[model samples]
Target: TSQHFDTCLGCLACVTTCPSGVQYDKLISATRHQVTRNQERTFSDNVIRTLIFNLFPYPHRLRPLLVPLFIYQKLGLPKLVRKTGLLKKVFPRLAAMESILPKVTVDSFRDNLPEVIPAQGEKRYRVGVILGCVQRLLFSPVNEATVRVLTANGCEVVIPKSQGCCAALPEHQGQAEQAKALARQMIDSFENTGVDFVIINAAGCGHTLKEYGHILADDPDYREKAEKFAANVKDVQEFLASAGITAKLNPLIEGDLTIVYQDACHLLHGQKISLQPRQLLQQIPGVKLKEPVDAALCCGSAGVYNMLQPEIADELGVQKVENLLNTGAELIASSNPGCSLQIKKHLELQGKTVTLMHPIELLDYSIRGVKLLRK
Candidate 1:
């Protein structure tokens, strides 16, 4: 009230805060009296606000700028930046942010890893896996594990090299045009092959790929293509669960390994796939599936949130760890790559030696009948 006594711009940031607009009776006259007093508007403030909004959310249109970033990480120039003091100025924010964000791998899954198809003397359903840009890099092993389980179940896997970015990075950011163009690229490559399904290892990408119909809803050509293409989009676990085949479990886990699951928001909320993964886990011998409280709340590592907004992500991650702590379980398994890592890191800080795993990893264990825990 004292600040408004002299003059104001009537910004009324309170309008967004008001539940019923009851502020009208007391503040409007005071605000109007000040609006007449201060007519000079600042130009620099507008420029700063516009620039902040333009940079972060418009990623699809801005992906070109990230090429150099990926290149630097690939070349391992972060060391050069640190040694030369260039990091302080060049990427001050990113340098701070990188504490949580894993550096780009020297070998992206696409370049170094070879995808394996099962040697199951019987070839059954043919499917292709869509490895999104980031997942194609960091979580290659998880994708590889996905293929192992698929092929073990008599699937002839065909991972088309052309099945590139799912455009999900931009789709969620409201950069629809950029996402559509990339989506068209992915649809053309997979549709041409006439595969039975396009399995997605990451739940987030699967959800986005499944929603290509909505992304291209207005496009005359793309709408039809996306609809047909989306019919094939399946998260690996969803495909496995819905395949109507008897799931196999080896005699590996003789004793109960209590696992508290952190459900990925994209898997549960985005794809409405809350129960399938849990049901699959129940099939394992002596495996106890423990549900953490409020499993629906996000672990805060939604796609790029953990990387771009570390503070908020950290808050959420810590909260999730608290929930896991209450369960007193040693294993925290999830499907999404970022969530596995973020939850793993936060839980580790609390001196609780919890193992964060991909649900696909557990399926891999049940198939292989060998424990792969890090000693």
Candidate 2:
């Protein structure tokens, strides 16, 4: 049972496909939590899981390592390691971790966004933004883009400085106690924000944020609060589409810009949001959206699945990239940080050079009239 559950991608694709409308995601989630409590693991498995749970959920903990990581990448050590294949031969898990490291920029070390940003025009809605752990640290630009896009749409954006991880990573991995603790912290962070909607740019974190009700159902004090919080949570794209985008958008590039939107499973299946993102993208001037062959397929970056199960993740990543490439689209619009990183790694592995951006990032460029640099 443990082995079988380990192989499941937890992408919730099955939940979307089931004709009977079975809630397999909930079932699997409950089962995984039970397994975590009952099952014993090998020492090595414990070590890796311990390392991941400790580091990935906390931004302050992850910040210290970035300087060294920046140095490592600046020295082109990753290229040398990949060329030698020493890391893969000796420690495949660590190799998996290294393979997804993005080109760290000076921007990665900065968190310059203010706690509150006013709307560009008359404010239509005030929304709180939840910056996921990896989303804020590694893909900080995406959060910035989200804020810009939201404010441009006549929405005041509030980022609770107290916010941390939404427990998406641990929740998916069946770390029940830790997930609950983090969920409580997330709810507390947004309690006093007084926003109309809590916006999340990352798909996985959005899904988890919306599930806080279920995650805290047993906690008598938080049950009602959790449900209220979950009710207000919205993916940034979802909110913009429903509330309507009022901002003027310019062409992102000179010519017709073709893009294929990669569906992060959490947004596509978990939240039933396949259309909202594309709708927002198409509204941009001179943008053309293309459909991939397997548009609903997972990119193997289901949270930390790529890091934990590298072999299966590599195969899925390769297949996903191939499908996206087959569309003949010039750029890929990825809404989740994990998907962006996993897709990036496989693109490098296959020696392909297609550009990838978060949907919000593209929207930001359009709103600000900044031309996209296309290769």
Candidate 3:
């Protein structure tokens, strides 16, 4: 039963496909939490869980490792290890960790965005952007692009420096107490920002943010506040789609660019936001969106599932990459960091390369009148 539950991807595709409107996501979450409390995990499982819980949710903790990671990748050590097959043979979980290591950049080491970013032209809304834990550190460019796009669309973006993890990782994995604590801290951080909406670029974090109400419903102190916070939370794409595009979108490339928008499971199934991202992308001049086969299937990056269940995640990742590539798109647009990393790793493994970027990043380039170099 534990194995059966562990293997479930928690993609919530069942929820969407169900005719009876079953809340399978909630059921799975509750079951995972119960398993954590009652079941005894193996020694290896405990170690992996401890490592993930301690490091992934804290930017400060993750930042220190980037320098070493950068050096490791720069030296081509990751490739060497893959060729040797030593790590995967010995410690598969650690091998999984190494597999999705993104190429670290200078932006990975800094938090350069200002606390208050003034809107271009007339401001239509004042919003707070949540710079998620892995997002702020690993995919800082996404956060940067998100801010630029939001500001270009006439939003005064406020990023509270005090904001930390949204606890999506813990929350998804059923570390209930830790998740609750982080959710409380998240609420406290943004409570005084006075922004009309709290925006999240990463789908996982956005889904978790939108569930603050349910997550904290039992807390007497935070029940009402969490509900209010959850009410105002919006995925960046969702907000932009609803608000409508005010900024002019220039052609990203000289000719029509065929791009595939990979739907992160959390955004599509968890938040019920399938059309908004496609609508926003189609607004860009000379941009064409392509649909992949099994577009709604999980990429198997259900939060940290890729790290914990590497073999199964890898199979799903390969299928997802194939589907995306079958679209013959020049670029792939993804909204979630975990999905991006998971797909990227599999793409690399297959000795194939495609330009994968956050939808917001592509939008940022279009709004800024920058053209992507393409063959």
Candidate 4:
């Protein structure tokens, strides 16, 4: 039973496919919770799980480790190590983990952004944004781009300092109490903002944020507040589409760049959002949107699935990468950081030069009339 639950990626793709309206998401979560309580694990498995849970959810702890990693990258050690296969020989799992680390900027966007960024022109709507746990450390630029795009299009963005993890990790792993504690903290952080919408750039976090009501259904104190909170939760793409773009976008150079839009499982299946992100991408002039062969398939970055089940995750990543490469696209746009990282690792392993970006990043680049940076 534990092995069966472990194999489940928690992508919620089955939820969309089931004709019987089965609540597979809830079932999986409950099963995983039972596994957590009842099952015993090998020492190595216990260590890996403990390390991941302890590290990924805390940006402060993660930041210290990035210093050495940043130095390693700066010194070109990553390339040398990969070339020599030293990591593969000594630490295979760590090698796989290192392959997905994005280029670390000297200063994270979180350090620069203020609590509130006022709209550029006329203020159309006031909104709150979630700066997620791993997202804040690894993909801070996405949040920065989201804020810039929102403000450029006449939305006042407020980022509460009190905000913490969306609890998607714990919730997906069946750590119900930890997930609920985090959810309660987040609700307390954003509830007083009086914003029209709560924006999230990470698809998994967005999906989890929207389900806070269900997660906290049994809490008498939080039940009503959680429902209200969930109602306002919106993926950045969903909010931007509904609010409409007020900024004028410039076309890419030469008026041509093929872009493959990879749908994050949470965004498409969990949240039932498919068209809005594509609509936003199409709005940019000179950008051609192409769908992968298996558009409905998962890229295998279902939360921590890549870290836990690296072999299976790599297989899915390779398959997804092949589909994207076959499109002959110059760029890949995805909303989730996990998908972006997973795709990027596979692209690198395959010796591909295509750039991977968040949908908002592309929109920001177009609006600012800048070129998309490639890896």
Candidate 5:
């Protein structure tokens, strides 16, 4: 029983496939919580888990570590180290992790975004955006793009300074108390803003946010509040599609780019949001939307799955990358950061040059009439 649970990606793909309408998400979450509380682990496992939980959930803690990583990348140490096979010989797991590490920029979105970004035109909706933990540190551009696209479409984007992690990390890892605490903090921070909707760009964060009601169902004080909070939670794509685009979209100045939309498991399986993102992508001029084979299958990023289960994660990522490459697209658009990182690393390993980006980023490019640059 625990064996299956241990290997489970928590991608919620089975939930969508099941005909009985079983709540596997809730079941798996509960089991994970029990494991965290009762299960024992090796010293190495504990150290790794501690390092990840302590650092990744806190931007301040994670930022300082990036400085050395940035320097390493800038000095071309990554290539040199790979060539020497030093990491593979001394620390195989670290090598696997280092291979997938995304390029970190000096300026993070936290340093750039103002408290309030006014609407570009007449304000139709006042929206609050959640800058997730890992998203803030690793994929700040996605949050920045989300705000740009939202404001361009006549939405007043309110990014509360008080908002912290959405507790997706802890909840997914089975730290129930920590997850609840963070959830409450987020609720207190965002609910007071009185925004029409709380928008999230990362699919994993959105899924966890929308399940706050279930996470806090046992809390008498927060049960109603959590439910109300969850009700307003919307993926950026979902919100944009429902609200309709008010801004004019310009075609890519460069030639038409064929994009393969890789459905983030959280978006497709967890939230059952499959079409809205693709619809938004198709709306962009000079953009050709193509679907990869097994579009519904997980890219194996399932939160921290890539880090914890690298071998299995890499296998699934390779398969996903193969499907994506077969589509003959110039770029891969995914809503989740983890999926982006996983897919990106595998593509690079396979000597592929396809760009990985969030759907909103493409929309932002089209809206601003800018050329999409590959990394």
Candidate 6:
């Protein structure tokens, strides 16, 4: 634990205020003891302390690991696991994480795709839409909204034929080598396509792809190539806003709908985008925009943390959902897919009708004649 505990403690002053079982001062003393060679590093100490989880854990078994995860959600195992308490022994923090457990939705974004859309038309700009693995498999509707809005705004959409994981999943899990390989492949595939920009619906992948230059800075052939590719990656929301696509004047629903906007970690922290979506959404005729109390904090659905570090993720997700209640927004708006599911589930568990949706869907609704979102 000392391997990273010291650095973690240094970064997070909250460790000093931690009232958890692991006394903060004791952890600090343990770190000192380990550094003084008084204790041998155990396997957990080595793996947990050092942030190299993705590298070895995923290893050559990425697809298998990810597939089971997808299938588990599909089978509603997360909810069952929460209900059964079977994992409480193995994972003592299971109950602490239950509130934030983003249960499986009725339809994952993947099942709703067009699988194949028409080719590039004679539009002013033709861009390659990077439908990331997570976005494609879980948050597919975001992509649909993105495509609908983009196509309606006079741009051609092309899902790269040779795209795979952008290396975000592996990179986050500490599999640097695998992630780098995927990033290189992504660059090669997109460069050959001759598109104006790479549109990304998921903020996480957008941030990761934007790091292609840094991730490949050591490679000779890929350094400049990666740099060039990373420069073109655009978050779907930012891209639309930059293009001056005004939300269409449509007759919105007559009933009441209060919406709160959650600034996803990547969209705010990584991309540093603040005004685009907010300003765009404000253009809507009859929509009340609500802001969270803790305006700047991670929702804990940071990548696969909801499944891996369930407790901590759940704690953060529920706290986020509670913060949303302060604004009384009936719906949660997020740019990231992971945050959407995480917030959506917490709200559902509370017996509240607060739903998770993308800002683009709202923007699309305003732009299009009718609400594209299905009930």
Candidate 1: tens digits of C-alpha lDDT, residues 190-276:
876657888998877887788788778889988999998998888887888888434467633556788887788777756778788
Clashes by residue pair, model 5? none
Worst 10 residues of 5 by lDDT: 104-113
TM-score of 3: 0.99
What residue pairs clash in candidate 6, if any at all?
53-173, 54-173, 54-174, 54-175, 55-174, 55-175, 109-138, 109-140, 248-367
**Model 2: CA > 4 A from native:** none
All models, RMSD in angstroms: 9.8, 0.9, 0.9, 1.6, 1.6, 7.4
For residues 243-304, could you state the per-residue lDDT of candidate 2 as single tens digits?
Answer: 99888889999989999999999999999998999999999999999999988889998988
TM-scores of all candidate predictions against the true structure? 0.74, 0.98, 0.99, 0.96, 0.96, 0.76
The lDDT per prediction is 0.67, 0.91, 0.92, 0.88, 0.87, 0.66
Lowest-scoring 10 consecutive residues by lDDT in candidate 6?
A: 5-14
Range of the 10 consecutive residues with the lowest summed lDDT in candidate 3: 1-10
Clashes of each: 0, 0, 0, 0, 0, 9
> Candidate 3: where are CA atoms >4 Å away?
none
Candidate 3's residue-wise lDDT over 109-198, tens digit each?
998899999999999999999999989998998899999999998999999988999989888888999999999999999999999999
Which scores higher on lDDT, 1 or 4? 4
Q: List the candidates ranked by lDDT, beginning with the highest.
A: 3, 2, 4, 5, 1, 6
Model 6, range 1-375, lDDT digits (tens) per residue? Answer: 434533231211233235773533234433544453544566544544343334322323333444555677778677788688776666544343444434334444224444335433346667888877656644656777788888777777777666777776655544457778899888877776777888887777787788788778789999999999999988887887788673355634665456788887767756777688787776677677888786766777776556555666767777888898889766678888777877777777676776677888777766676643423
For model 3, state the Cα shift of residue 196 in Å: 0.5
